[model samples]
Target: FSPIQRVNYKIEETRVGRLTNYDKLILEVWTDGTMTPKEATVSAAKTLVSYFNQIVSPKKVEKKEVKEEADVIGPMGKLSVEEIGLPTRVANALVKAGYETVEELAKAKKEDLVKVRNLGEKSIKIITVALVEKGVKFGE
Candidate 1:
């Protein structure tokens, strides 16, 4: 994301400026002709997108060795929530809701966790991120 690509303009002199993407070819925006900020932004963005789309560029993809799923340990069903280093409150809530292990937590849905006491959106996000790092996902 370039600072030049996105920006908010204020009151300035009505003039023309050139923006270049690649090949050193200049794209001149006739902002003086544009009435509003919306018009200028839309005109500039459309010009860039259309110009780039028209350019033909071929990209090559390289095949890499695929890792077998069997190599990953997968979910830890026998491990407790505390063992996974979850927050005390979140772990307590999961335990109270009958989700003791990582496997149980992975099986739970977003709706089910919302019903659990003391667990909110933030807690769910943390739990989901941790589980994802362990190759465990909830709600299939």
Candidate 2:
């Protein structure tokens, strides 16, 4: 049996500026009586570092042309809620309510969106503003 009893993680996206974003990862690990949580965490970290060291090199890498989903899904509607740059909590709430894309959200009624968990008038207003900025509007 493994010494780890449970593991949990949460990822938060924070915007540093207009174009820069950073992700904060929070990890919680539980262990049985056999090993201390600190020891287990240290071991995991060392293992990850070893793997990363093996894959990474000192040479410079070339950047590739990445395609945007908007090209395939249309224009603004295809854009993801995260891409719209809403707060992490708001974006997660919207996605949880089955509104993953801007187009899907635009077609949803304000009353229905308000019923989603953790969403209220302020979140609705934020969504409205974001959609408007993208040249879209919510359904009546």
Candidate 3:
């Protein structure tokens, strides 16, 4: 529930190339403390675009079945490094070093992680604490 506080719109006659009678809509949206105005506007725009797309296509769109990350990795392994509350720098380093998931990080040796760029003892300690809080052990 994104609490939008206010919404305003204005229509103006505009020209698009040779089309001089085209109407352009300008929307101004405001939100409560719950969500940012930009977020609300983007969400509304996406919803409208989707509806327009469906209207134009008419035919029902077939949704492809996407495999869940948990299926490829273990359940806990599907958790992203960022989800463990690691700092952006530390998480980026781990992800760059092919430790994107909690399972991969949990299985990595401290020495191996230390070899990764931008990671050190402090980062490792932070990662360890976060993993332990999630009932996971750092390192094999």
| Alpha-carbon deviation at 120 in model 3, angstroms | 0.6
Give the lowest summed-lDDT range of ten residues in model 1.
Answer: 1-10
How far residue 35's Cα lies from its native spot in candidate 3, in Å, is 70
Off by over 4 Å in 2: 1-74
Residues 11-84, model 3: lDDT tens digits: 99999999898999998887787878888888888999999998888877799798664444446677889887
Residue 9 lDDT in candidate 2? 94
> Cα RMSD (Å) between model 2 and the true structure?
22.1
- Predicted candidate 2 versus true structure: per-residue lDDT over 45-102, tens digit per residue: 9999888887785446789777553442358877899999799999999899899988
State model 2's lDDT: 0.84
Residue 76 in model 1: shift from native, Å? 1.4
User: In order, what lDDT does every prediction score?
Assistant: 0.71, 0.84, 0.84
Quality of model 1 by C-alpha lDDT: 0.71
Candidate 3, which ten residues in sequence have the lowest lDDT sum? Answer: 67-76
lDDT computed for candidate 3: 0.84
Pairs with backbone N, CA or C atoms under 3 Å apart (clashes), candidate 2: none
Q: TM-score of predicted model 2?
A: 0.47
User: Model 3, residue 120: what's the lDDT?
Assistant: 90
